[model samples]
Target: MRIAILGAGSIAYGNAALLASLGHEPVLWSPSGRSAGSLANGEPLVAQGAIEGRFRMDVARSIAEAVGSAEVVLFALPANGHRMAMDAAAPHFKPGQVAIISSHTSFSGLYLARAIAERGLDIPVVVWGTTVTAGRRAGDAAVNVSTVRAKVDMATIPVSAAARGLKICQVLFGERFVERADALAISLSNLNPQNHLGIALCNFTRMEHGETWGQNENNTDSVGRLLEALDAERIAIAEAAGYTVRTIREHYHLSFHVEPGPVGEMARELAARGNGGNGPTSTDTRYVLEDAPFGLYPTVLLGRLTGREAKLHQAGIDIFSALYGRDFAGENDLLGPLGFADMTLAQLKALVRDGWPVEKAA
Candidate 1:
């Protein structure tokens, strides 16, 4: 399988390396161009971790060149940056090519669907909430592979492309795809928002002060409670949106080595599993900044539109937005920015009842 990964971050490099090691042609691209240069020189650096047999592959020169006759154009960019990436990539999309958001968050495939439609183009989009596995960038061009996600919950935007989308993802990741009902479940299933909002908001000082902290180790019962609160908000949003989202605990046990435990217990164990001496680090992480806009905010909106109260979800957004001094509730959201603002509570309910083929646009 020919694959092109956008973004040269740890996640990108790690996945690229995996594809290359499997003898699949892999190409990497990034705006910074540094990672690309490194890869082109045949010396893409990779940081090792719990997962064995890891190495980085060289980055690609251009988007067109990177995807050179490749059927799968895999995007490793964060959910927050997906819109911009799609905008830049819309022109490059050719028919019969599958564009898989390596991990879709917050209606990403729908966003791409809208983008492609506006451009008068159509293609397959496979959207997965979390990556096929959990990994993090440890250093420049180096990423730590925590574990290959046991299951990748997914859904195509239109809900009609599941078969095609699943086939493409299976080809790339070797059968880790699990399709959901619609894009809404994918939005709710993204664990980064809940975990990040809780951790980053609670441990803002550590993040801002640049103090090194491990996730599973430092996250205590209190952090677990807060995260649970956040997760409840996410669940509330899903319920209100008429989608049954799996709890965080289910995601952890299903996606990682942790056996079934309470949501917080799973978090702690996951932290312990990640490298950082004892736990996953929270410092300068993508936990909040990356997930809030696409993950948290969307969950909050779903709650709002559905008449479900999501105090913690809303509070987390406010706290993080204040911390960053930016309106995390920007035009990047689905319920908010995508003209879903006009949707009344009852109207939103109606949409949920008419799922699968999408009755509103019907």
Candidate 2:
């Protein structure tokens, strides 16, 4: 299948190479144009670690050009870009096109569905809990991946596209998708925000100071216990909502190759073994900026609706907001537009089970 990858980040480059290696035509496009321009002008995309190869992909200068002929559109960028990306690409989306958000968090599919509905288009939006592979940027169009996860959790919006979406993903990437019931369950399945919350709150100073400390090694016993507490809160919300989300322990084992153990000890072991402890080197990283608002705040919102208090999650958001002197929750495009205040818990659940309400205003 022809795939159009919308984004010019590490994840995008890595997946592009993987897809190309799998014999699929993968095209690249970036809203900013810089990343795509760089690749288009002849920056070869090189992959190392788990999947090794150097490949080149067609780069589209505009959203129309990207989705013009592609059967699949994958947003490999961060949660913040989901809204803008969907808006730009929705008009060009074909009737049977499959839309995917690799590592979907922060209700991205609902946001995409809203855009698709506004355009009166029929498209299946697939939400993956995490990317197939994890890696770091070696250069502008190069990525070094250390781990290719055995499987990643996923879900499709409208609940009816589950089978077709899963089949497409398994064919393109590999047979590694663990399908869930709805987007809410997939949202809770993402462990990055909560895990990063623990790391950020405990190691904020280290980030500010630009300390090159080991992220996993620094997760002392105290930090690990705190992480577990936060995970418990997240799991409680999932359980209250009747979805069985993965625990942080299982997350580490699946995503990072760490065995199941106490959160801190497993982290420490990963750090010592040099398997997967690397993280942000500065305070300006996504750990706080992206995760806190896009990831944690929505979680807090869900927790409150479910009558389950995600104290640590809410606390992280509050502390980060105060420290940064910005209302992080206000930054999310989905929440305010979602109009959670006007809707009840049942309505929200129905929306996730179904797709976005066509009558609702964007």
Candidate 3:
């Protein structure tokens, strides 16, 4: 399969290498046109850690060129960039192509599906609860590929396309996808927001100080307790919404290949085995910026809709806002545009499951 990956960051590079390893052709497009410049100039993309290889991939300078000949189009960027990428690629996406959001956040999958629907195209948007590969860029054209998750929760819009989306993902990545009831279920299934909230709140000082620290090593008993508490709130919201999502312990165990245990213990175990990666070194890190608005804020919204109070999640957003001197909740560009704030619970559920412009009878 020829895959078009839109984003030239660590995730994009990591996925490109993974696809190349699987004997598939990948074309990369960096929105800024800078990240993929070296790769486009004939430099080989080097991937280390979990996926180790030197692979060559074509780099497309424009969105149309990238999605034009590809069977699969993957969005491998941050949540903040999803709208821009979708706006650029939606018109070019034809009927036969399948779109995969590496990790869905802030209901961005629904935003993309709506855009495609407006163009009269029925492209299956596969929304993953989390990314397939977790890693960071090591160099201009190199990525330290972290663990490719053992299991990833996924779902497709239009409800009826679930099976085809699963098969498409398995063919491109592997047999690691577990389909959920709907995009709403997958949205609630994302554990990053709650987990990251606990991690960032307890270690904000360390991050601001720019000290190099072990992410898992710092998951101390106190931090673990906080994480568990946050998880409880998230699970409560999920249950109220009538969906069952994974626990933090299960997330760590599955993503890092560790035994299921207490969240902090799992972190320590991962660090003991040399799999725990370093924590963020700067205040601009995604742990707070991306996850706060796109990850945490959405959980708060869901809590409101389901009549469950995500107090801790809301607190995280508030504190982060004060510390960063910006309104993280207001930072989500997709929510307002999609009119999520005015949506009723029933309408929101139908939209996610059935795609945009909900059926009149539904």
Candidate 4:
């Protein structure tokens, strides 16, 4: 299958490499055109670590060109860019095309579905709970894939399209995709927001000071306890919302292939095994910028709808807002536009399971 990846970050490059390795054609488009420029200029995309390969991929200069002839359009960018990417690609989406939001955030899948519906087209939006691979850009056309997740939770926007969506993902990515109840469940299933909150909050000083530290090593007993506490709040919200999402412990074990135990202990184990990657050296990271508003804010919204107050999640947002001098709560562009604040629990659930404009379903 031909796939159009809408980002040129490590995840996008890594996925492009993985797809090429699977004998599928993968084209990459960098919104800024800076990342993929080198690749477009005849440099072969190199992926090391978990996925090792040097392959040539077509670089698209525009969203229309990138997704024009692709069977699967994958949004592999940060949560903050979802809206802009969706709007740019909305008018160009062709029939019989499947959209996949790698590690979906902030109900962006619903937003994309609604945009496609407005065009009188119904495209299945596959939402993954987390990314398929974890890595960082090594160079302009090179990416270091840290690990390929063994299992990834996924769900389709419309509940009825679950099977087809899952099959398409599995066909391109392999059999590691696990189907969830719905997009809402997949939303709750993403542990990155809560996990990153604890990590970033606990290590804010290190990040701000640009100190080099080990991510898993710094997840000490104290940090682990905080992560566990945050996980409790997220899990409670998920349960109250009637979704059984994965715990942080299971997440660590599955993603890292480590023994499940206390969050800190697992981190220590990962560090001891030399798999614990380095922490962010700068303050401008997705931990706060993307996850705070896009990831945690949605969790907070869900908590309200489910009548479960995500105290820790909300506090993290407030604290991050103060630390960063930005109103993280108001940073989410999708919720306000989607009228999430005024949506009732029942209405929100129906919109996620069925596409937007509920009258169409009726």
Model 1 residue 118 CA deviation (Å) reads 3.0
lDDT of 1 at 171: 71
Give candidate 1 regions above 4 Å deviation: 44-47, 50-58, 270-284, 331-337, 344-362
Tens digit per residue, CA lDDT, model 2, 1-362: 89999988878888888898999999998878767565788877888888898888789878899898799999988878878888788888878888999878778788788888787776788998888877777777688886788879988887887899899999998977899988889888888898888888888888888878777778888988988898999899999988888898988887777789998888888778776646677888878888888999989888888999888888899999999999988888877766765767788878888896556524
Writing each residue's lDDT as its tens digit, candidate 3 over 101-205 gives 989999999889988888777788999999899888998889998788889999998788999999999999999999999988888889887788888888988
- Candidate 2: C-alpha lDDT: 0.84
How does candidate 2 fare on TM-score? 0.95
TM-score of each: 0.87, 0.95, 0.97, 0.98
lDDT assessment of candidate 3: 0.89
lDDT of candidate 4 over 165-215, digit per residue (tens): 999998999999889999998998899988899998999999999999999
Worst 10 residues of 3 by lDDT: 353-362
* Cα TM-score of candidate 1: 0.87
Clashes of 3: 0
Tens-digit per-residue lDDT, 91-204, candidate 1 = 787777878786776666765766666655556677777876456666565667766666888776556667887877777668777778766677778877788777677777
Lowest summed-lDDT stretch of 10 residues in model 4? 353-362
How high is the lDDT of residue 142 in model 1?
62
Candidate closer to the true structure by lDDT (higher is better), 3 or 4:
4
Residue 339: error of model 3 in Å? 1.1
